[model samples]
Target chain A: MDKPIRVLVAKPGLDGHDRGAKVIARAFRDAGMEVIYTGLRQTPEQIVETAIQEDVEVVAMSILSGAHNHLFPIVVNMLRERGADDVLVVGGGVIPDDDIPVLKEAGVAEIFTPGTPTTKAIEFIKQNVKRK
Target chain B: MNLQERLAAGDVRALARLLTYAENDYPEAEEVIKNLYGRTGRAYVIGITGPPGAGKSTLTDKLAKALRARDNTVGIIAVDPTSPFTGGAILGDRIRMQELFTDPGVFIRSMGTRGHLGGLSKATQAAVRLMDIFGKDYIFIETVGVGQSEVDIVKTADSVVMVMVPGLGDDIQAIKAGIMEIGDIFAINKADLDGADRTKIEIEMMLDLNENKAWRPPVCKVVAVENSGMDILLGHIQEHRTFLSESGELVKRRARNIRNELMDLVRDRVMEFITRETGKKLTVDDLVQRIVAKDMDIYSAAQYIMEAINK
Candidate 1:
């Protein structure tokens, strides 16, 4: 059987607003990707552990809190240190435009801001996921 | 090191990678499982199944924690439905069990039932074996929110804990026959709700009509989110485990399950082989398309399939 692209959509840091994450999870499912959604308030360690255990090719986190610059890169680095560098780590939700380049330099494959269509994220994952 | 050595040395990444390959039916995973098959059968498998919104995942999280507090290594496989049209799924069972994410003693995997392949239960059984080989003391297989007739978990777990909640479809769901009989233990989660006792009595009445009375399935009230009644639920599950052990039914039951799973595995493989084309030959799918177009009959298609495989 052909394997579907597996993605882990999580809400990291203290922000509990997960409307964006849930929307992406649903969109991923509709796009024929198996998404493992770990609900709100996850730490970076918890996110990376789940991504590893699930063997997900993509880790897409949505954080509304102002800690994306701090927490998102930590998750990316942890995945790399854990030998999970193959995973495509992406971040979304309330972040300034200037920090996007910094996040990209920190090994985040892409950053989807609020107005970015879910299809763009889906397309990015399709083009970037290592498993495919 | 090889896969077996890595697994033996407690490599989580290797285990996770093997599980992916196993689910996709890769030959490397088959070789590893063949080598480590003897390491299985030591872990106790518990199946948590119920309708959607029954709190099975929450109950599962609490149960694993309870077992972990007693220093037992736990493995959990939480199953969710795959989309029939899109072949995708949202395996969000971990949303409730996220607290166990970092616990080295617990391994939780979320699975989607891609029935287009029809090998879901087979892969699930293999996953259980792999987890057992990984040295878990208790393995919990939580089924997708099931209706009647999705009882494949019976072929995987030694004990099936059927979860129930109050006010779901009223008394109709309680009286449903097929899934109701498979519960070795009945848990009325969200028991703090209004109709809990009524649901309990409904289960008792139905269980009294069970054909095999060797063991009486206990109906326990539980509020999983608050963690109340968990101890009693744990005690009852333990007691049921001991009963199976004492009466020697555990061995007999496992053997029966293995036999059934082996039969399913053969069917899965044969179906896989038949659907794909052999060189330039017409496969079963093409034959079916012909039958649909009235260019070929069903009997001739069947004969062609038989003859092609015989070659």
Candidate 2:
């Protein structure tokens, strides 16, 4: 059988509101994607660490604590430093439209804002996942 | 370096990648396992299982902690149920095991029992083998011990520890036939809770009813959160390991496990070949169409497929 797309749904940097992350995780699962959710309040380092350990093809971060600007880039840079730049990074949860291009420049493939449909994110992952 | 060389050099990323390959049953997984097969057979595999809410995760955390304290490098595989519809799983075992997260000595992975044709057990064993090859001294396989599916635990672990808690009436009755029979060591967790003694007595009584058994499983009472009775439980595991080795049961059990693995792998290969062949010509849909139209009976279709397989 074909290997399912492995996606790590992480809530980084003290984001206690995990309802969005949980929802997305479930959505990904329902879409037949293998998701590894590392619960709430994870660090960028821990998130990257888990992403690598899981050998996930995508790292989807749901940040509501407004630390996405700081945490997301650290995760992206960390992945690059670890020779894992090929792993796709995406973000969701309260990310501003103004910051979308910035995050994209920082290596985030896409961002699903608060009103975006979960299917959009799922499709994004399926389309953007870097399968080796 | 290649995966083998990196793994031999103690690279964590290499280990993780190998484990992923094994868990997904990727084609490269077989090659990886074959390459590392000679380096395996070193880690002591212990399977921890019990019904849901029996504190299996908490107990696994404590056990991994104890093993780490003794300077043993540990690998943990916590298996949770996957959604049959989505093929996705929310593996929350790691939430209870946060302490081991940052510890370099411990490598923890949570797997979903995707029910992909008995794939959970096979993936788990493969993960265990990868961890073993990576040089972990102890490997723990934690499963949601509900039904007969948990029999896979026995086939994988050198010693199987069944965790239970008191005050849940019919808990033993629910799992008695399958899980109860396979436990090498029984743990009544939450010993501080009421009926702990009664639960212990129940298991002891159950054991007493059995006859002609060379080794009897011991019941250990533990308050997992307090970390009490863990050392004793570890001691029992060590004792069981020693007994298995001394009695030559280790060799026998491992031989049986390998035989089962070989058979399962052959079955998987056969299925893969058939699927590939059917994809190219004579799709399963075509067979169904024939059966529906009464052009081919199901039994005859099976014979035809077998014949095709042979050809």
Candidate 3:
């Protein structure tokens, strides 16, 4: 049987504003995926460690704190250092279009900005989740 | 390297991969575990259980920290409920456990019940055993918020800590059946809340009526999020462990748990046998149709199945 995609919904910045993260977590659950919501104030190291420990196929993070330029790449790089680069890393929450290219350049699979529908994120995960 | 080799060499990724295989029940998992079964039985499993909105996760996190401070490795399997309609789950138990996320001594995994009825997933047994083989000094299996009759934690845990909060109920709620009887330690979490003393007293009253006095269950008041009273709670856990060993109850309990596990496996194997191809013309599908159409009673179907097996 095919496994449901396991996504780690985490907020990897200092921001405690997890409304967006919670919303996406709920959306992933409704779409028949297992979501491990790691709650707020998670650092990049914590996020990467969690991604490995949970063995998640996708790490969907939300950062409204504008620190994405620094933190997002750190998580992607850490996952690579841990040889878990196959995990589909994605991000959302207040990232500007200018930073999208930068984060994508750092190996983030995709970046969803505000106003992007939850269905889009769900579809993106379904299509890109790495299955070994 | 093969999974067993890497696992023996202390590979966390291999351990995590095997856990996934175990959770999914792939055939590969059985092969690995069958070979690694002999190395298990060293880890002490403690079960943390309570109703929803209780601080079970918080309690688990604090307890893991305490154990780590004592220089022990801890593996935590935290269970949450799956959505019955969508067949999905939001496993948010580890949200309370992020403090221990980067700690190498602690490994935390969250599980969804996955339509399993007893507040634990069917894969929980395998997860526990895998953690045992991974050389953890202690294992904590925190169940999904449980009500009466969801007591599968007993099958996996050497000691059970039933976390309770103030104002969950009055007299009738305090002494309810099924769950109230299983605790080796009754921890009144959220002890800063009102009526904490009353809740503690209520559980003590309930314990007084129990017939088993070999080890009287202790009632401890704790504020889990504050890290308050955990030393004493851990002391009680260690006390119970010593008591079990000194009293020879550990052997008997482990023996009984093995019995329950054997029965569970047998039931699954039998059901699989009955449902799969029988090499005969008659099938369970036909038997089910007949029963649903009222042409045959369920007892007749069972008899027919038994007879077919005999033939």
- Give each candidate's fraction of reference contacts reproduced: 0.88, 0.56, 0.84
Model 3, span B240-290: residue lDDT tens: 999999999999999998899889989888777777644366689888888
DockQ, prediction 3? 0.82
Query: Residue-wise lDDT of candidate 3 within A1-132, one digit each (tens)?
Result: 246678899897787799999899999999988899988889888998888888899999999989999999999999999989889999999988999999999999999998999999999888888774
lDDT of 1 by residue, A35-103 (tens): 999899999989999998899999998989899999998999999999999999999999999999999
Per-residue lDDT, model 1, residue B271, is 69
User: In model 3, what lDDT does residue B83 have?
Assistant: 86
Model 1 chain A worst lDDT run, 10 consecutive residues: A1-10
Q: What docking tier does model 2 reach?
A: medium
TM-score between candidate 3 chain A and the true chain A: 0.96
User: Considering lDDT, where higher is better, how would the candidates rank from best to worst?
Assistant: 3, 1, 2
B224-258: candidate 1 lDDT, tens digit per residue: 99999999999999999999999999999999998
The runs of at least 3 residues in candidate 1 whose Cα sits more than 4 Å from the true structure, single-residue gaps closed, are B116-121, B170-172, B276-280
- For every candidate, how close is chain A to the native chain A in TM-score? 0.97, 0.96, 0.96
RMSD of each: 1.8, 2.4, 1.6
- Candidate 1 chain B, poorest ten consecutive residues by summed lDDT: B114-123
How far off is residue B310 in model 2, in Å? 4.2
Q: Model 2: which residue pairs collide?
A: none
